[model samples]
Target: MKKRSMAVMAAFALAAAGCSGGSGGANPSSGGAKPADSAPAKTEAPAKQVTLSYALWDKNQVPAMEEIIKKFKEKQPNIDVKIELTPSGKEYWQKMETAAIGGTLPDVLWMNGPNIVKYASNGMLMAIGDQVKASGLDLKNYPESLVNLYTVGGKLYGIPKDFDTVGMWYNKKMFDEAGVKYPDGNWDWNAVVEAAKKLTNPGKGVWGIAADMNSQEAYYNTIIQAGGGVISDDKKKSGYDSPEAIAGLKFWTDLIHVHKVSPTLAQMTDTTPIKLFESGKVAMLWAGSWNAIEFAKNEFTKDKVDVAALPKQKQQGVVIHGLANVISAKTKNPKEAWTFVSFLGSKEAAEILAKTGTVIPAFNGTQTTWVKSTPQFNLQVYIDMLSYSKPYPVSKDTSKWNNLETEYFKKAWTGELKIEDAAKQVATKMNEFLAQEK
Candidate 1:
């Protein structure tokens, strides 16, 4: 799934308590009248029916999720589930925060790296570590990066659902028409520059690539490749002002300004980079594995496009991020919620998701089918990238600094400010925000 901007919510305190009561059997006939009565026959209580609300943002994955839910229902007949779809981005987080405040959040919902810390730290999500231990669920079945992504403050709050990494998507037809060699794993940043130069054809009104200013799909990968980072290892400071980070930022700026091989920020804003690629206006695009289905379904790109690993800079690097299934802290049906979430994290559910070709299932052995699902493209590149992938940077109040990034980075993308100047500004202000996170 594509990364979305999260909306900040004011923190609110909440407390929950559990109570239990039991009756002592036949409190010894103190009244004397009941001593002669026969002992009552024991009767078993009927199972309680439960309906769980599952909230998610991506409608495209609903079918696969439904299939999993159908299988879950066969095993858990008393627990029915309802799916609630909300458009991703600010709206989804806004609604979630509202639900958190009101204690009306769904029993189960999707969580991502950026907001996991915020929610889990605020006690808005249930910690599933104990449940995982009790169930004897081996987390080694999922990628270590993904398992770590959902863990906050030594507690696991979410179960990994799926993962995605960025790749270089190229239009084969454009490459053939331009007589340019196809990109491969061995290619480096210099190779991309040279190929882009050869691929750009002004007379045809086609740019070599769409170097859009996106984090996960663009600069974040470049930053790590350049041996810089978005945040410090401690997550307490910004690394944007470092020389390596500046070099990473310059990579895209040079693509737009120095070489003129990419569409300007304004041009991309008018027609998104994906649209440009879909319409054959750009020869190449960098996007997540989630775009495979859409590209395969698109008329222009279905047969003509293929994927390759992103070109290396100082070294090979890509940003890895994924979604997780988390339970709401306020959910009344905690037992049922855990049951459903635990099922969702199982190998069976991952296999079902892989078969849909919608995502790379986080479960290790299950991704093979997902790689095979889209045979037209080299979907395995994304899987291979996991070897050198870095986790997407995040902090407790990620949205706060994320907003600052967009604000300052846009100026650099548009050539309104030098890349170094803009990055430095972001680093300064981002550090200030980071200091206030607690």
Candidate 2:
């Protein structure tokens, strides 16, 4: 599909980016004694109709997942399936938390890396080793980085659903107008800055970039470039105090406040950088491949918008995260619930998921066709990036720390706080967080 120039990306694409993902804690189903590995041990209870609720936040993919459930019904006509959507982003987390406290979480939940540790650590998540073994999901089949995200304390609590890596998304028409050649994977930070400067035409509302301030979006890449760890060896120290790390962050800070090539922090909060890019007000947005699905909307076909890996800093790396399917330890119907969870992790399910264009399925090789589902942009970057991808930072409180960075980052981005001061304070606060976590 050709990309759309000066065209608006479908509105949902922007919403998808802002929507934060989370899941609730779940206990084993009532009387759901952990079943034996061989066949699901039959229950002595009456064979009443069983309803399994699947909770997901992305409304866009709900339709596709529902289709899979329909197929599931063909196999087990007696089991009824229900679909529930948690409002996208933060609201979803709150809802999940409430469900967790109430012990009414859906039978199967979408699991993101950040909260898996928090939930699994609390013993709310069901152990999926038996399910994976039964479903024949050899942990070795998945990329180590992705599988590691949900594996804690030697227990694999989640089944890999899909994974995506970050990439640079650019507006093709803008590049042509600026007489700038398209960026290649080989481009460096200096090249990125130079390109952004040429792409700018503030008088006309076009800027070179929608500078991403999210650490998950930018700083993780920067940390790798700086050759510093996001956390120390003991996982109890902040790596932000290093000069290289500061320089890494300054790359974006300079682009906004100093170089004046992107919107200010306040501006970004109101109008997302990607929306600006899609609307032709900006030229580039660094986002994950999970987004490529929504960009499949009518406007972005045939080279109008496209993707490439981010310009290299001191290091060449990318951030990759996958959503997993985790069973709640609190589930009352483990035998029945495990069947659904196992089915979702099977190659058959991955194939269905791959067809939806919602995410890059985790069952390797199944993701090959996902990029082809989009016409507006080149999805090759995301595929290539996976080879060099690293896991997003993990912690018992990924929210507490990431939220801290997001809130304080605006200070540096808005020019209200100097970069050094901002980085220094961030380091201090991060260290303090590490201290408390310990």
Q: Which is the leading candidate under TM-score?
A: 1
Q: Per-residue CA lDDT of candidate 2, range 1-438, in tens?
A: 224311112211111122333222111011221122223212222255688888788877887798788876776666776888876756666666666655677788887876776667656688877666655545544555556667888888887787767788888889999999898889988888889999999889788987778765676776666566565656687777788778878888999878899888778878977677767888877877777766666364334778888777667877667788888787877767777776676666777877777778776656666777664567767777655555566555666666667667778888788877877787798788678663
Model 1 TM-score (2 dp): 0.87
For each candidate, the alpha-carbon lDDT, in order, equals: 0.80, 0.69
Which prediction has the highest lDDT against the true structure? Answer: 1
Off by over 4 Å in 1: 1-46
lDDT of 1 by residue, 1-438 (tens): 112222323542211110100011111111222211312212122168989999987767888899999998888888899999886545677777778766688999988777777778877899988888777677766666677778889999988788888899999998998899899888888888888998898888799988898887898888988999989878799999999899988999999999999999999999989999999999989998888877877999989999999988888888778888999998998888888888888878888888878888876677779889889989999988877777778777777777787888899999999999999999999899889877
Query: What total of clashing residue pairs does each candidate reach?
Result: 0, 27
lDDT of 1 at 391: 75
Q: What is the lDDT, from 0 to 100, of the residue 414 in candidate 1?
A: 91
Candidate 2 minimal-lDDT segment of 10 residues: 25-34
What CA root-mean-square deviation does each model show from the true structure? 13.0, 10.2
